[model samples]
Target: MFLKLLSYPRSLIGVIIFIFLTAASAGSLVIVNILFNNRKIEDHIVEFWTRNSCRLFGVNVVVKGLENRPEGGFLYVFNHTSFFDIFAMNGWLGSFRFGAKIELFKIPVFGAGMRRAGILPIARSRREEVFKVYQAAEARIKAGERFALAPEGTRQEVESLGPFKSGPFVFAINAKAPIVPVIVKGAAAILPKGHYIPNWGVWKRTITLEVLPAVDTTPYTIDQRPLLQEKVRQIMAPYFHGDDF
Candidate 1:
């Protein structure tokens, strides 16, 4: 009974901290957006927020593999395991927009901030919405904006990646951009789905953001979609499931 009673205050405190951090970060983003016309400057704001989040949650991010970003436009694909994946990626990657859910655009400050920051939102259930989102992403790439997407569609608690969604590949094909596979580890254990509070422990967590060599889809025709998808899947398998790809 006592343990259960103590849970309320703990949850409340966590909620308060979340709100405070969110507001502080949002305010900083707004200021940066207004003051800096450069996209790189805006990206730094996001990186700052992510780093702050890691500190606030006591997350230790240890990146591995190639960190060099390609010189031109590319579709970045990564494994999704937790919401913290956003922070982990944003902290490492620079000058890229995100492909996110449309519902996130309705979340007051966060939604407005994301839209302003060039994040493309889509309704996962609606095919038309998906197309619209892809079009926007393609346009952004044409305009010289790099973008990141999670082909897993949603977070999978297991180490193995879920089936690759065609949406990201479609964007890559349309934009004629190389597909860069990114792998992240240890986010799920820090904060899993359906859990509001992170499991705050002293153990150090390793978060890798590997930028694999870009995959070229130029030679493959539209009819060879399956081959293209399988190739990306194979390249990502090792990092997704902790094996050597």
Candidate 2:
């Protein structure tokens, strides 16, 4: 039934409405953030946006493993398939900051809100900026806040996962926070990159945020960095290839 709507001429109107709602919600969220110093209120605002987004697009979000991470202060590493992954993950991982590109900080209302919410930004081209992001992330973790990052760095459509970046692992090692791997499936089909219109349908998609056991970096020295990186990759294998890690 939803797919049928996508073929209708009125679908464009729906898309416009979605954009308007997004802008309005973002504005309201910024106001809320200013009124209350508590970050929890801002999280609630984002959750509301997430729910509305899914509804506007007629997408079903089935969440699993909510019991994982009963508290905060963990690094969330997830597969990057589409833009929707941001909202989907945020809906589940409440009150957590995200590590994004510095360019995103320039985007009008959304970017300003993200910056005000304490999202970490890194200049991908500069090596020094990478360490700066790491330092900022470590400080946030120490301050009792959690962070999420997509190591793939960009969106790609493939059955197999891309090579995981080493930055996330390094941050985890330095911060001594648990590495949580989250798998988001079916978002690519809903909306792919370089496409304006959503290929909407009554699609039922699954977003699994499995929290594996934390990697203990206490005993390992900096010389064992390669082994530590491999260990984190092995733990993430289950989501990528269905292999038992």
Candidate 3:
């Protein structure tokens, strides 16, 4: 019925509207950040925006294994899918900040807001600037603040799990924080690649967040990041159906 109601042209038009709505919400986030100058409030704003977006898009999120999340100082890892993946995670997952590529932190109001929203800028190498960011992350981790990461480094529309990056695992081990591997199913329908997760054909769909048991990072050493990364990937692979665009 939805397919009958939404033609290809309409879906394309809908995507524009979707992008506009996202932009407006993000602009509002920037305003909130500037006015409040508070990380906690900024967090609330981001969560609120993400929730409203799902509602607007007629997307439903079912979070399974939420109980597996440990209290404090956890590094959550996920399988990257759609652009909506970020929103879906924030809406269902906690208001924990995300660790993103450094280049994303350079994009105008989006970047500024992200900084106040406490999104950690993860760099490939240790330049002085990235070094300082790492220093801050270590302090925050020790202080019991939580964070999330997509180990695939970037989102792609694919049928299988991408290679997991070792950086986040290293970060987790460095902080002695537990790693919560999550399988996010059904996000690729929201936006694919080239055209967007999967042709933007889905208006209403259920996105599931299956949070697996947290892998204890305390025993992993810095040099063992690759081993730890593979271990976490193995744990999540079975549950990740990829449900891609």
> What tens-digit string does per-residue lDDT give for candidate 1 at 1-245?
65455545654565577777776666666667778756777777788877767665556776665544667788889888887888888876766888888898888788777877878887899978888779867766866778889998887866568888787887788888888888887788777877667544333456667778889977766667778888999988965545443
What's model 3's lDDT at 196? 49
How many pairs of residues collide in each model? 0, 0, 6
Model 3: how far residue 15 lies from native, Å: 4.3
Candidate 1 error regions (>4 Å): 1-15, 31-36, 201-203, 240-245
lDDT of 2 by residue, 117-161 (tens): 777887778868887778777877867788888877777675345
Cα shift from native, residue 95, model 2 (Å): 2.5
Error of 3 at 223 (Å): 2.2
lDDT of each: 0.76, 0.70, 0.75
Worst ten in a row by lDDT for model 1: 198-207
Q: Is candidate 2 or candidate 3 better by lDDT?
A: 3
Q: Write the per-residue lDDT of candidate 3 for residues 30-58, one digit (tens) a residue.
A: 78777877667767778877887677666
Rank the candidate models, highest TM-score first.
1, 2, 3
Stretches > 4 Å off in candidate 3: 1-3, 7-24, 123-132, 197-199, 241-245
